[model samples]
Target: MGFKKDFILLTKPYYCVNILLSLSYLLAKKAPGICVYLFTPKESECELDGRETEILFFLAIVVMIRTRKTGSVTMINYLTSSFIYTKIANLILWAYADYLYGVIFGVVFIITALVIPEPTYSGPEHVTYFRTEHALDDELESDKRIVWIIAFYTVWNPACVNFAPIFSELSAEYNLKNFRFGKVDVGRFPATGKKYHVSDSSLSRQLPTIILFKNGKEFLRRPCVDVKGKLQTFFFSKDNIKAAFILNTLYKESKENGITTDEKKQK
Candidate 1:
């Protein structure tokens, strides 16, 4: 009952005067000798705690306007509030404010999750780390199983950026909590380049390379040279590139074994 009345008053700002008048009358009736604070006159006329009252009054106005404009309370409202409070608390070192801000931030994030879209991905998450000395050694030593995909590219290549997003999407999709992804900037990670026999010199032209690994061993590697023609022909076609990945990683063994019984059956 109390909540409903406050909500109603929130919408009809004019009702605030009547509500305040009723509150003052009740307080006067309960304590006849005590002075009562009645809501009257413009905010400039208020004598006690005028600043606090003004802030509250302004907040109420903002709420009224936003509610009318949006037609519903939105998660963005809470998120914006939380962000503001957090920034204030962090800069001001206000522990109480920080605590409240943290709570609001968490609550707002939950609300946002109900409406915001989750990001999607396009390919295998882990890529090779080819440019570090003992990169493979470190992976082999780690207790966890790791998947690696290494993209080989030259500094002069203009086509790499066009393919970067699709590759990132794939990585996002496949990047499991336990699994990891790494990039071997062949130009930067010289040892990685040497380990993979990739050359930075113009003569070698090692751009658009992918190497996959599991348990520190190189399971699959797609050298830029191997698919030079195909990559150039369908570099921007996600489906084509994705199919190529399937061919290299998933169907490598079948192709090595020659025409399988499944293919014979299909034929």
Candidate 2:
């Protein structure tokens, strides 16, 4: 599945090049005499002798190629494809100057051959954090194997910064097939914060909110506060969190599923 996504991303430049080439061909067909004449200096005696048309076509092609290459490279990097593959693919595509429907069909065939659904993370130690709201939503909606414990945080908050390492340590200690940990930066995804009712104010009280979800619905949250709405900062510690949540719920679920911490340690 990763390979398929990389393949599609890698060939995007070629797709863009094909579309641009087709558009240019259509435009040239519309004014064949002017376009062909521009390429041939000897045909300068033609009525449409203006060099502006030729220069515009040249500039358009250059801009199209440059923009497509930039976009493709950016996407490949974002998806974290192999550096060697990226270099080789970019070199080949950069050398390619012509486009054809047959070549486009070939690309489509290759993509279809490689395409597969993304696999779930099966590791027991590390948590898989999400960068976008869409991805987080999709994962929650589609996967029901695990109870998701998502930390909604912002980088600018000192409390959140302090809690990051603690969260990582907890994830390493308590990770199981039935319980998983994730995090989203509210600063990067304000919509996600809003959807979860965490970051409504500029100085959000719940800057480092932690929510537990099962079967796509939220069941619990952290930073238990008082009637005056002041956060209980002391309860955010690793040992406290484990006693309150992990031991009571996640541990029970893992045991019911026949997975023990002893088994994890042995692995």
Candidate 3:
């Protein structure tokens, strides 16, 4: 009875089952029996059981390859597979394959769960920025009349390291003819750091702080404070990272569009 129940459960397609079956065949000392069953009007023997077992055993290797090449399935995908496996495994009758599957499934699960990708930088989607002083001058002087959002970043700060790619993606998104994105290494330019007022005592602990300039006059700075308030005050609470990024950019845009009243108006 248990053997029949377990056999039924094994027919389901779930990652854990596939992984466990694969591991079991891999660990077996003798080759599994090459039995074939005919399942059609035409009498053709298909080695379904053996082939499936072999495919399952090789699933981890394929996963690793995919992860290296494209990327691992996201955490949610992994969890969904785990749940499907759990449901099928709960109904299994033959305890050995189920037990082995459980163990091997656990191992592969942990391995994938622990894997983390290397950090990368992705500037905004549609934005483009000039890197050199000459290019900056050229763009500013050109008929395009670009607004530059320069990412001043260092590689060292963990916060900056994490934010760099995100900033890049945002830059790319906002990249257009009227506006552009650029990045500079603050560590490479001490004079530029002084000129931008990006330093340890005040602004960001991260390497890449965002600054907006029009015709080379600084309009807005972030992760930095103006006379009004600290930049972090607008962003840090409630884990509102997306909001922070949007608000910061919007503030700059508002000033550029002449929506901002001068400090004198507020006073």
Best by TM-score: 2
> Number of clashing pairs, model 1?
13
Candidate 3: lDDT over CA atoms? 0.46
What TM-score does prediction 2 earn? Answer: 0.46
In model 2, what is the error at residue 172, expressed in angstroms?
0.7
Tell me the spans in candidate 2 whose CA falls farther than 4 Å from its real position: 1-125, 200-202, 224-234, 258-267
C-alpha TM-scores of all predictions: 0.37, 0.46, 0.40
User: Which stretches in model 1 have alpha-carbon errors above 4 Å?
Assistant: 1-132, 154-156, 224-237, 247-267
> What lDDT tens digits, residue by residue, belong to model 3 across residues 62-147?
44443322211333223323332332332231133346645655565455445523323322254444455355445555532346
What is the per-residue lDDT of model 1 for residues 226-258, given as tens digits with 9 covering 90 to 100?
Answer: 444532212333465456666344334423434
Q: Taking the candidates one at a time, how many backbone clashes does each contain?
A: 13, 0, 25
TM-score of 3: 0.40
User: Compared with the true structure, what per-residue lDDT tens digits does model 2 show for residues 141-214?
Assistant: 76565688888888766456546656787788777776788999888988988888888355566767888887
* Residue ranges of candidate 3 with Cα displaced over 4 Å: 1-117, 121-144, 200-206, 226-267
lDDT against true structure, model 2: 0.58
In model 1, the Cα lDDT at residue 57 comes to 57
